[model samples]
Target: MTVKIAVLVSGRGSNLQAIIDSIERGYIKDAAVNLVISNKADAYALERARKHGINAVFLDPGRYDRSGYDRDILKLLNNYDVDLLLLAGYFRILGSEIIDAYRDRILNIHPSLLPAFKGLHAQRQAFEYGVKVAGCTVHYVDEGLDSGPIILQSCVQVLPDDTEETLTGRILEQEHIIYPEAVRLFAEGKLKVEGRKVRSLD
Candidate 1:
């Protein structure tokens, strides 16, 4: 069975493009990107999706409250019968309704190794904290902000002179790699979340 995936993005969607490329190259075994959703109408992600001939829609977050936004998102997901929801740089803090509706079906990629920097400016946070190691996290989306069950993480060493942009650039390379790997694991039924840990079954 092909796992139907819907990706939500609010930016350039480098991770989204990685997933799409992975599917095209058969790296993600039985997964298909059904649709791409963006809260900003001018998000470059939509253009990326259009270039790949994938269905893309923009739902204005400003028009709706949190509950209404979730309702709209849920409706869109159901319309496509999407089995998996991927958040790649999606900037909104999802409400409980969205989390409850999708439960374990929703996934997100955060820039910093989670539990360290839960909210925005993660790269900057890492730099400010003076952590030598920084990385990205792929996790199940939950009610808490970036406080979800961990799926996969890839670490990158922070150079002594690294700025936020430099650190983010390095982390993003790992993000492109691991995000697709995490999605592939979900599609193959290889990921099992227990407590705060995610076990990958071969």
Candidate 2:
């Protein structure tokens, strides 16, 4: 059975593109992108989805309250029978209703190692903190901000002369690689969450 996915994005949707590429190349087996949702009307992610012949929808944040916005998203997910929700550079912090509805089925990709830079400016936070190692994390989306059960992580060494832009570029390369891997694992029923950790069954 193919696992249907609905990817949420706000910006360029590079990670979304990675997943689409993987599925097209048969790297992510038995998986299909059912829909792409964006809160911003001008998001390039929607254009990317259209290029791939996928269903794309925009839910403007200004139209409703937080709960109402979540309700609308949930309604769309239900209407499509979407099995998994993936957040790739999605700017909005989802409300409790969506989290409760999806539970362990929703995933998000974060720029930092997480538990370190949870909200924003993660690459800048790493550079300012002078961390030698910084990377990306793909995890289940919980009620807390980037505080979900970790699914997968890949670290990149921070060079002494690295600026925020350089560090972000390095991390984004790994993000493109690992986000699709994590989603493929979920699609194959190879991921299990035990406590705060996620394990691959195979």
Candidate 3:
């Protein structure tokens, strides 16, 4: 049984590419990236999807209210028969319409070990806060801002001389690894969310 995936992005989608690569490499099985949706018209993710022969979609959020925009997106997701929604670099907070509709089926990868520096600029936030460790997390998206159940997290040490850019680079490396790992687990039916905790079963 292959899971139909719809990837949402807002910018250059390196993580989206990672997922595609993982799928192609057979690291993630029983899943196919059926569609790629971007809110920004100029997002490079759309081009990447087209290059790979996946359905690419662009929606102009400026044309509608937040509710209408998300409603249209929900319609597209339904039309494409998406089974899992992946947020690669999607910037907007998902509306309740979509969130409630997908629930745990919507997966997101954050740049930091969540419940820490959420919102935006998470790498800079950790560096400025003088944290000794920083990393990335893959989680289920809820209505709250990065307050959903965590699925997987990997950490990196903060070097004494690390700048924001250096730290971001390191964290992104882990993002590439863990995000694909998370998707693999999800595709394999190995992840379970019990309360606020997620268990990775073998």
Q: Global lDDT of each model?
A: 0.92, 0.93, 0.93
Superposed Cα deviation of residue 188, candidate 3 (Å): 1.1
Q: Is candidate 1 or candidate 2 better by TM-score?
A: 2
**1-202 in candidate 1: lDDT tens per residue?**
9999999999998999999999999999989998999998999999999999889999988898888988999899899999999999899888888788888889999999988998899999999999999999999998889989999899999998889899999999999999999999999999888888889995
Cα deviation in Å at residue 45, candidate 1?
0.5
lDDT of 2 by residue, 1-202 (tens): 9899999999999999999999999999999999999999999999999999999999998999888998999999999999999999999999888888889999999999987888888989989999999999999998888999998899999998899999999999999999999988999999999999888997
**What TM-score should be assigned to candidate 2?**
0.98
* Consecutive 10-residue window with the lowest summed lDDT within model 2: 114-123
Mind giving the per-residue lDDT tens digits that candidate 3 earns over 24-137?
A: 998899999999989999999999999899999999988999999999999999998988999998999999999999989999999888899998999999999999999999
| Candidate 1 backbone clash number | 0
Ranking by lDDT: 3, 2, 1
